[model samples]
Target chain A: MIKTYLGIDVGSISTKGVLITENREIIAHAYLRTQGQPIEAIKNLIKELFKDNKNIEIKGVGTTGSARRLAGVIVGADVIKNEIITHAVAATYFYPETRTIIEIGGQDSKIILLKDSVPVDFAMNTVCAAGTGSFLEHQAIRLGIPIEEFGDYALRAKKAATIAGRCTVFAESDMIHKTQLGIPIEEIIRGLCEAIVRNYLGTVAKGKDIQPLILFQGGVAANIGVKTAFERALGIEVIVPQHFLIMGAIGAAFIAQDYTQKTKSTKFIGENLLDINFKTKTFECRDCTNFCEVIETYKNTQIIDRYGDRCGKWSEKLPNII
Target chain B: MKVAFPYLGYDTIALKKFVELLGAESCLGPPLTARTLSLGTKYSPELICLPFKITLGNFIEALEAGADTLLMAAGARKCRFGYYHYLQENILKKIDNRHCFYAISQYTPYEFFFKKMPQIFGVTPQKVIYATWLLLHYSALIDYFRKLIRLTRAYNFYDAQKKELEALRIIENVSSFKEVQKAKKELRKIFSPIINTSNEIIRIGLVGEIYLMLEPFANYEIEKELGKLGVLVVSKRSLYRHLKHLLKLDLFDLRTISNAYKYLKDSPGGEAIKTVGEAHIFAKKNIDGIIHIYPFTCMPENIAYEALQKLARDYEIPILSISIDEHTSKTGLLTRLEAFVEVVKRKKFKG
Candidate 1:
């Protein structure tokens, strides 16, 4: 049987899965919208990733993203990490000289500065959603342009119209105002792209040294418009990796490979997790005045996992908490 | 009379002992929770710093717990913290007028420890002096307790947490000055087993506003979180140090100011100068990284944030400044912290 590692990233907006060979090669990959249902999304993505390979034995599993804990529990992952570390691992692995990484996900934008393949510093956009995938998706819908074609229209612009991008509310109003001014729709779209790049650099990437060999990953990298804007603004080439959308999955796989090789064991429950009925429920714990909202993940009838309780009264119970 | 003051996480024990020795029953506001924060937020002016809101909530809870005298530390000319007690008293009077509101001026060490406390507690100045002495010693004990907890937790968290609970019990039961020393010994004994097999541990310096530094709830138990991530947090800001600073007996003051002069020419009020100074010290000591946390929109800390960037560049150390508000989500904070730990560890391993 061929040895392989499984990596899953369950984000707020999307869920991604990837299978890698012992030599760190992509064997299979899948991406699907989470749509507020992470469990189902992971299961569906799992089915798609593992369906094409039958002889491969999963040696280890890893999970990352906002829903990393839930994904870890679901897959019995050997390695669970935040997106920042995972993203950096993948970027530096692909581009060893990568000095900076620009990652714009569904609701957050992050700028990670690396020196000699190690992350030196980083920053995430705080309390702002002005320059993320969701914002771009919203503007695309408002302009009656499919997000897939949004970049091509941006490419069509001869001269981009100026649009405010400091705040989402302001950006929306400015976009509407530009539409009323009869500026070409393509120019308006291009302007929106530049505005996003401008805001991202000003806020998330502020004061961060943007050197050569920068890689832009996450969901927003699919937009060539933003990529082009970044290149023009920074006067540096931005490389979008072959598996840019699934770079986090790739990184998780690398981490899992490192962990399982050290421990010589795999906790991965297998890719047939679809047969299990998984559900999660949250209840307010009134044990103390804190009133922490305790969450429990159930496998069929038995409660398999619990969290969110600060005092760990519910979470510390091992195996079957109930 | 039952006395109450704002809670300062585990440091509450020392505060309680200080009040009790002064001949008044101590009633600290119930451990900070969402309910207290919400109650405090309801009456506070929009855009006020988080410390103000949380302390107001503590006072409300204290009054509800039958505390007859509310003692709040007051100061303002250097920072907005001075006006906190004034505003809090005005708001608390509307909620309950039966309790007396006393804004203890913090800068006046002699007046506060000898005159004010003696007058309030109907005790001799000599008794008040002893209580003040105990307060300093007890605060230092807790400060040492925090360090032990961080070191032990970073060494091995699974066994270290239970020892922490037992250690807190030991710290709380110390009533005499000698017992404070005994408690410290017991704490080291409780943690020594777990910390025995300790290996390479990454160290991060935590320096920011004094209130944020001392209060675990205010900073969301950041020291504990970093310790759990296998990072030994070297945070020097403590209530013991603050008291020393207030009394003009702090020996570390000269170095902090000289360091501040490297990045800043003058103080911008509050602990902004101190923040830069501490970050400078942490950098020179070769800390893996530095985490700076203060309330969002805090003027003094914001100035410190700028000086910190230049310091980070000069020292080539990663400094993360987190501006916290009521809306700061726990999940977001964890993600930032976890990523930061990875960054620092990676940097250290490379070197």
Candidate 2:
């Protein structure tokens, strides 16, 4: 059987999983909406991946994204890394000369500066949604356009309208006002695409070096209008990698491949996890004044993981893993 | 008189002891909590800094707890902290007219020790002098314990936390100078065993507003959070160091001040000078990063934030500036801290 690595990226808005051979060739992949339920999404993703690549023997597994810790526990990942490191590693793997990475995910955006195939500097948006894919999705729905076609509308604009990019509230109101002024729909869409690019540059990528060989990845990279806007704003061509949407998952697979090679074993629980009944329960721990909200995941009524306790009163009870 | 003071981190115990030594019942406001912050925010101007709001809450709680007299530190060279007492007194008097409030200037220690304190407590100058000396010693003990806790918490968090609680209990029970000396030895004994000299830890410098630097509650126990991330925190601002600097007993580091001149030629009031100066120093010392914290609506620290950002770029040192207020969530703060620790670790690895 060919050795393979599995990578799962469970983000707030979506869950993506990828299966790769030892040669770093993609064997199978699945993407599904998390819809606020990461465990269910991961299960579905795993089942989908297994349906296509049943013969491949999983040697290692890794997880990344906001819900990485939760995904790692469910999958028994050999490596659990943050999105910043995983994205950087995957970008370098695909484009070795990549100097900068611009990632606009569902709810957040980040800019990574790399030197010699290693991330030297990085910054993420702090409590801002003006420059993310979700913001554009929301605008698309409000304008009665499918999010998938929002970029095509932007590309057809005769002249891009200018919208405030500093805040989502301001930008939305400005977009509405421009529409009321009878600005063309295509122009308004293009304006929003530019606004997102401008906001991302002004906030997340602010004061950082944005050099050549810049790769834009994540959910927002599918928007050709935003891609063009980024190119126009920076006066440099921004390349969106082939596996743009699944780059985080691919990066995680690379990490798992490296880790399992060194350890000579994997902690992966295998495709049987698809059939396991995983339940999550959350309660506020009032033992201390902090009143931390503790989340516990149980597999078939057996507690497998506990987290979110600041004092570690609950998490410390479980055997350490990941 | 039943005297009380605002809780300023661990130094509250020392202040409480000082009040008790002056032949008065020491009533500290309830330890800062969510209730205190809410109470403070309710009565404070929406645009004022966090320290003002929290201290206002402390005075209100103390008065409600039947404390007849409230002692609040009064003035500084630059910053709205100087006017905090004046505004708090007005606000408290408006809320209730039964309590007596005194504004003790932190900058004028001699006048405060010999004149203001003696008059308020109706004590002799000699007794006041002795109490002040004892307060200084207690402050030093607390500062030493803070440093020790920061160091040990990085390696063994629970043990350091337990030891810190024990140290606080010792500090609270000490009355005489002899007891203070004994308490110091006992604290050393409690903390000595937890010292693990591991060279594999990252060192971070914390700088910003005096209140945020000294008060864990205000900054969401950031030093402890960093410690949990295996970071050795070196904070230059503390109540003990502030007291020494105010008294002119501690020699000013001219080198740090000169380093600040490269970024900020003059003090912009508050702790801006120290914030910038310390960032330069931390960069020179090759520290992992600097976490700059200040209250929302703080002008001096806002200026310092800009200078620190420039310094961060120039030296390639990562700096995380956190503006805290009543609405600052613990999870949000922790996320930023985790991301920052990752960044610092990656930078260290590359270097």
DockQ for each of the predicted structures, in order? Answer: 0.64, 0.34
Give the distance in Å from residue A198's predicted Cα in candidate 1 to where it truly belongs: 2.7
Candidate 1 lDDT, tens digit per residue, A1-322? Answer: 9999998999879899999998999999999999999998988988898787888999999999899988888878998989998999989989999998999999888988899999899999876889799888988888788988888999989989999999999999998998998889999889999999999988787767688888999999999999999999999899999999999999999999998999999988876678988899999988889899998888888887898877667877855311
- The reply for model 2, stretches above 4 Å from the true place, is A320-322, B178-181
**Stretch of 10 with least lDDT, candidate 2 chain B:** B247-256
lDDT of 2 at B35: 74
Q: Report the C-alpha lDDT of model 2 over B1-351, residue by residue, as the tens digit.
A: 888888888888888888888899987756676777888999999989989888888888888888999998877778898999889999999998998999998877678777988899999989988888888888888888788888898887767876777778888888877887798788888887987875588888999998888888888889888887888899888777887787777665566678899999999998899899988999999998898899888899889877886797788787887888887778667767876777788778862
Window of ten residues with lowest summed lDDT in model 2 chain A = A120-129
Each model's number of backbone clashes? 2, 0
lDDT to native, each model: 0.88, 0.86
Q: How do the residues B1-351 of candidate 1 rate in per-residue lDDT, one tens digit apiece?
A: 999999887788899989888878998757899988899999999799999989999899988889999998888467899899888988999999999988899878789767888889999989988888899999999989888888887888767778777888898899998999898888888887778554898999998887777887788888877877888889878888888888788989878999999898799988888889988999998988999999988999988988998998888899888988788888799899989998998899882
Instruction: Give the interface-residue alpha carbon RMSD of model 1.
Output: 1.6
How well docked is model 1, in DockQ terms?
0.64
lDDT at residue B8 of model 1 (Cα atoms) = 83
lDDT tens digits, residue span A88-186, model 2: 889999899999999999987888877788776677776467868778888888999998998899999987999999999999999999999999999
